[model samples]
Target: MDRPVNALSKAIRRRLGPSRLRDVLHGVPLGHPLHPAMAMVSAGCWIASAVLDVTRSDPRASRTLIATGVGMALPTATAGLADWSTLHREQQRVGFVHAIMNVTATGLYTGSLLMRMAGRERTGRALAFTGLGAVSVGAYLGGHMAYRQAAGANHAESVSHLVPLGWHDLCSLKDLPNGRPVRRRLGYIELFVLRLGDGVSVLADGCSHLAGPLHQGRVTVEDGDPCIVCPWHSSVFRISDGSVVHGPATAKQPAFRTRLRQDGVVQVRPAD
Candidate 1:
């Protein structure tokens, strides 16, 4: 089993370079994985069509719903391509199966749309039923990717819940210099600590976009306010409140509350 998996991995690595796969998987602008969103859209369209079947809607309404479902196919294709580009060998094997199922479903919908256009009511209804059934199966596999495999899920969100409320000794106040972002590790958590002239600020070291290391990022004061720019994707967060001033990141990084101890040591803890 291991031999086959290793051989497959090498083949995939040669076909899709590591860096190229990383870019697609990262979903740079949205911050979250694109596949989930596309899945939701596809699911919503099919569900709406199922609902429309029961209601004797006007011809215009039927056309609209069908159009929406057909339009959703574009993003579904984009998201699938992005996810497939990044999958590991074993994951790719599973993903290929998932993709084929979804493609079949999409083809069924396309056939349904054409039959409707041709005024073949009975045939269109049959095709829609087939497409709906395929969508249900595809949805189950998508859930497996999200919940079981944890693909495109944020692992770092669990870190804050594990730590105690009180401050832990980070480093001496003088150790971190002004205008520089330093990397510090606390257990499994890596932090990016920045020193200002009067105070210090800290954020999770990993970029929420693709887990890009923030320690190597640049510090620039945005709009006369202190904020740091992530070097990899340029996602910016404010120093004072840890709010995301700019994004690709819809979710803010976990910020740490800091204080200078009497012994000139700086202590840090996860903010409530």
Candidate 2:
């Protein structure tokens, strides 16, 4: 099951590529993932519909609300499916289950809508309640994916606090070859260090997309500027300032200020 789903997701992502539509679906311009916001809208409408189902005197108003809720769910599912395609295998596995539950809920609500239209009020209400249960379970799984697995989160968000303010010794500068990414440690923090000419650029080793090790990635030039392309997801970050050059990632990698100590040791600190 996971294999087929994984294959389909990868194929979908490959087909998506980089486009205005995909960016809009990703909520890049909005500075967040679009799926959750759309999901909330659909869920709110459904909640209102469920309340009206229980407390309303007129079945017309309840049915109208239910229909509206169902309408909102279409866009919500579209946004979710767009995000789902970009996820890693483990995340995709969980998200696939989440999607299945949501589809189940949607199917149930569709049946409920048909029943209501046919004047089967009690049967419609029963089906709507059952759909609500599916939504609840789906919501739980979605929460787990978001918070527990850190799906759609900036994996490098913690780097700012984790890296100390003052320069800390890492290793000898002579050991770092030009045009190669090296892993260095400043106390407990791991950093991706790259040398180009007289300058050394350092960033948090973790990819912002899914914590892919940036040091393991290939360093390449994009439009005459050095960039690190994450091995896991191909998220590209500028080596100069950690800005995202290309991404499934929306957050910038945490860059560091590098300096050479008098003893020829390389030291680094949090960037301004």
Candidate 3:
């Protein structure tokens, strides 16, 4: 399962690299994952079709709504696949099963739509109800991947509250080599430190999208500002203020204020 699943995901990811279509699917401009949001379209249409069936409302309208749901499912699932390709192994495994369930539900709903068009009202309603049940199961798994596993959540959300107030000693300013990114620890918190000329920039070591270690990522200059690109998902963050330069990451990276003490020791504190 892992082999086939990983191969599919990797192929999709490789094909999608930094394209505008991929950005749109990922909801980069909207600052959120688009999959769950767009899914509401198909789900709402299906529920309305069920209500029409129960109320014995115009049969023609009910059939139209069912067909509408089938049309909507295509784009919704496409958006979902875009995000699914970037998930971690655990999330991807669960997502694979979830995708299978959704595909099954869509097929059932399509059959129901065709039955209604053929004037087989009783059969259509039964298949529609069964499809809804399949959707429920798929939604449950989707929620687990999101809430339980924290698939698309901000990994560095706790940094501001966890670090102590005021300046905490990091290391001597001389220790960090020029034009290099290094990791430093303060208690349990880890920070990514970069030295460029006379200035030092520090940010939370973890990527906000999936907690990819920022220290392991490649640093590059984009438009004259230094940024780090996450190795896992390629989300980029500006080092100066930790703002997103590019993303699947909707949240800003937690940054810190750096200053030198009297003895030439460097220290950092949470940025306002």
Candidate 4:
């Protein structure tokens, strides 16, 4: 099952290779996942539409909510494309279902808005109700993607729970040159270690945005703070804390505490 799925994903990737559409959806410039942000905006509009339905009968309010809904759809579409482009077949199937449901809901809302503008009040209300139901179903599917599939959730966070206490040798302090990151493995955990003059920093090797290798990233100073610029997407993270300095990544990288043992060995443990 997994083999076939992998083949399918590879085919999809080949078909969509190096596309501007994929880049926009992936939020490549932001260095983080974009779906969650777009989802929040869509959800907000839905809530506002629900409120207007209950609190007022004015066509103007309905039109306003519908326009906002339409506006939110653009980012939602981008996010869906971004997520789908990189997904395995099983996840992609689920994502496709989610996308269909959400897009249908958007269309329904658009029709409702048009109906309301044309003074077809009852038909518009009916369409709005249908759209609301579809959006709810789409939201449920999105939750499944995040919680069950771990889509858009930070994979690096998984290591924080499993990393052993106290310092574990990563590499010799000399192995990492100043302003360059080195990759090392501790058990199943991969880490990116940076030597910054007198200090050192460690973060999970995978980027929070797209699992891009952080070891190949470049170190620079931003606003008087040390940060690593991801080689793949250029997402920047503070060296001291792993906080995102810029996004497509809303979540921070999993940081690790570093030390130099008396034997001059470099060590790291999950940061407290």
Give TM-scores for every candidate, taking all chains together and pairing residue i with residue i.
0.65, 0.86, 0.92, 0.65
lDDT of 1 by residue, 1-272 (tens): 44654565456445544343434434545556666776777668767776676575554555566668778877666656555544445555656666667888888878877887898866876887888888778777777766776555553363568777678998888888888889988777888898887587888888654466778987777788888777754657776666655644435678898998898888889887
What Cα-based lDDT does every candidate model obtain? Answer: 0.69, 0.84, 0.87, 0.76
Candidate 1 whole-model C-alpha lDDT, 0 to 1: 0.69
Ranking by lDDT: 3, 2, 4, 1
lDDT of 4 by residue, 1-272 (tens): 45654565566556655455555555655556767677787777776877778776666876787789778898777666646656645666777778788999999998988898888978888898899899889889988988898777665565767976677888877777877788888888888888877578888889886688889888888899988887765667888988877644546888888888887788788887
Q: Model 2: how far is 103 from its true place, Å?
A: 0.9
Relative to the unseen true structure, what is the C-alpha lDDT of residue 66 in candidate 2, on a scale of 0 to 100? 74
Decide which is better by lDDT, 3 or 4. Answer: 3
Task: Rate residue 258 of model 4 by lDDT.
Answer: 84
Model 3 poorest ten-residue lDDT run: 243-252
TM-score quality measure for candidate 4 = 0.65
**Pairs of residues at least 3 apart in sequence or in different chains that clash in candidate 3:** none
Among all windows of 10 consecutive residues in model 2, the one with the lowest summed lDDT is 157-166
Q: Give the RMSD in angstroms, all C-alphas superposed, for model 4.
A: 6.0
The local lDDT score (0 to 100) that residue 179 gets in candidate 3 is: 89
Q: Which of the predicted structures, 1 or 4, would earn the higher TM-score when compared with the native?
A: 1
Clash pairs of candidate 1? none
